[model samples]
Target: MGKRNITDEEIGLIKAMLKRGMRNDEAHFHFNRQDRLISPGRIAQIKSGKYGGDVAIANDTALDQFLAESQQRSGAPAKAARLSGPDWGETFEADGGGGFRVRGGETDTVECKLSFRMNPNRFAEVVKSIAGMANNKGGMIPFRGT
Candidate 1:
């Protein structure tokens, strides 16, 4: 298929999902109930770097924009096994540190984290991962020093 991009409607849905301010699990419950194309697992995988699509990200100060970058960076890959990759299972600890992902209205994935406080190595690894993703045609937006 051609380079897939998030559509206007999908953007609305994603923004709506973002607006709710819920964790992946909670968001999944809502999105699944609505029977949308993107799943909760897709959301997590997208965030964690398990999945990515072709799209140049836009710069913005909005949480959704920043978060989209974060998910693309630290989150798992789409092919990579996720915290809840399978369809039957769907339960995740919302450390906020756990990194949440979302992809829609755009092909790129987004990852976000809210850690209590991590050491240098963990932070560095996250950076490496983000850079890797960016180089691989993906993007990242890990939030540290919060």
Candidate 2:
């Protein structure tokens, strides 16, 4: 039979199954039982990072790369599930933390929080910024460390 084109989500589930100590045959059988078309050999290939396809992932870095490529292919704006302070393309210096010191500072999407919440207004501003980010194409809200 022809190879089934699996979604990234399915690939993630397979990865999870592998992490849970399930063998390739077990994962294949599990999926097949759920009516999903995946083979034990294919599952092994995916885990070995030899799956010659777009959804290839070997580790965290590879997964990040795969997700970025997938997002780019879909022509959809990147969604932020965590704080990725800055992009590699951006001109900035790392402060040895999950933050950046941009040369020119905040852009249309990048926002900075310089201090802790001292009052209701400041807390409200932070909340609004988070909501704005979630509602938009998603972005990083870097908070300065004291």
Candidate 3:
């Protein structure tokens, strides 16, 4: 065979995988294991809408169910809030992996603290951030750098 094109069914699975946060290389490996040859770059192009294919829509019901089930199995929340606005709290410095860097920033949705004190006022502010997030459709607080 000279070449084989991806079918609608494969496109659906690929779309589902992408939506589930699977990287292009990961998806390529997944399909290759099943004897379906696909390049990571091609997958990326498909995901980015650069190529034309019958990919599943974002609101696919089956994709949603797959994501929810995967999250449950992984013991993670189905949804998470992103940190918005500016960074707060003290300056933070740490390094992980092969690189190290230091930065201190806060966002509207996040309130970082260098340390937790027994001061009632500080505690109240922390609680206020939590309550604010809860009331404002949820957000994230890294909490004393972790």
Candidate 4:
């Protein structure tokens, strides 16, 4: 598939996000929406100064404004959960109630667990799954059950 092109303004925001202590994966999650795709690798390149080196970092005020605007656009609360898969293809957002809404089905980067048990076997499985995700591109696993 063709990758979405990122604009200079977005590059500035990415730089600012990194400078402000946001992880590359988290930055990728924030910027890579369903309609837009910013690869984690691209975020890494920006973090390492291999890309967007000429773009200026966005100011604090601009960053705040951008984040606010993003929340508004997504119709999410001030502290709603926003997550994406490794390919930056799918997005999961808070439903404003107590649940989350996902746009696509499970992928290599997105796993959904209907319930989570605290038993030793379940805990081991969860840890192994998380480690696998970390080894690959970062991913999100939202436990729906208590």
Candidate 5:
């Protein structure tokens, strides 16, 4: 079967997801279901500003609703798991299958990274983010493996 073209609405949602610190692969995972497949490269294009310039970002409310509905469709819990204290560690360790969703995307106390390589630029960015978080009550910097 031919790959389905992502709609404007989906593009908007993808923008919102990217804004919320979701990586391209993560956003792609949300849209690329078994019945409707979209190329990962499309998501990379969107992330790199090569696509979806005309589309408006979906609001957090819309994104949240979409996530809830997606969870329901997948038979997962309607509510995303909250990351806090020891529970956060337990959640991560327990969900060996990956793809677990966290409630309340990125916040002042939480930052998400796609990965952490040895490159100086990326390292510096991560350090700056950590310092910023440290300045304000400390925070978690979760790396979503690619």
Candidate 6:
């Protein structure tokens, strides 16, 4: 199939995922389904009030509390911090495949993942799915054998 385009419907879904306090991995799944790119770093940017819309939500207090109090501790995801840079469109990875990231130079960027693997052909479908997500959120996939 041809590459999918981002829609208001999909962006709305992303907003829904945001309101639910989804962490990086979960958000990644949702973004894949919605055909929008997002990483733990982007998610964090949204939460921290930097990327996307200019008008900040009124419930900053709630967000602050959530970040400060969530007990589901997690390792810090890698970030490239290039969202506004010339190379902001790429996501990088390491040699070994423990963790991979989209974009960079920002904290908590694309965190959630589809978290599955398949044969080469099947993996293409997964890549297509993530490609749409990346189009919407803007990043590269660095996961090995992804």
Top-scoring candidate (TM-score): 4
Better of 1 and 6 by TM-score: 6
Model 5 residue 43 lDDT? 91
TM for candidate 1 is: 0.23
User: What ranking of all candidate models by lDDT puts the best one first?
Assistant: 4, 5, 2, 3, 6, 1
Q: What is the lDDT for 8 in model 6? A: 38
lDDT of 5 by residue, 17-109 (tens): 999998676677678766887888899888777777778889999999998887666553533355667876543322346555434344445
Report the number of backbone clashes for model 6: 27
lDDT, candidate 4, residue 15? Answer: 94
Superposed model 5: Cα runs more than 4 Å off: 1-4, 77-146
Order candidates by TM-score, high to low: 4, 5, 3, 2, 6, 1
Candidate 2 residue lDDT tens string, 1-146: 25657666667756866776766754453344335556657788778766644553346565456546654653434432333445533545675687566534443356666565859767788788888667544677665556
Each prediction's RMSD to truth: 16.6, 14.4, 14.5, 9.4, 10.2, 12.9
Task: For residues 44-110, write the lDDT of model 3, one tens digit per residue.
Answer: 8778766545455545676567556655553433443443345322223454564323232333334
State each model's CA lDDT, in order: 0.43, 0.59, 0.55, 0.72, 0.71, 0.46
Off by over 4 Å in 2: 1-4, 33-36, 52-146
TM-score of 3: 0.34
lDDT of 6 at 28: 49
Backbone clash total for model 1 is 24
Residue 128 alpha-carbon offset, candidate 5, angstroms: 38
The positional error of residue 136 in candidate 6, measured at the CA in angstroms, is 3.5
lDDT of 6 at 65: 48
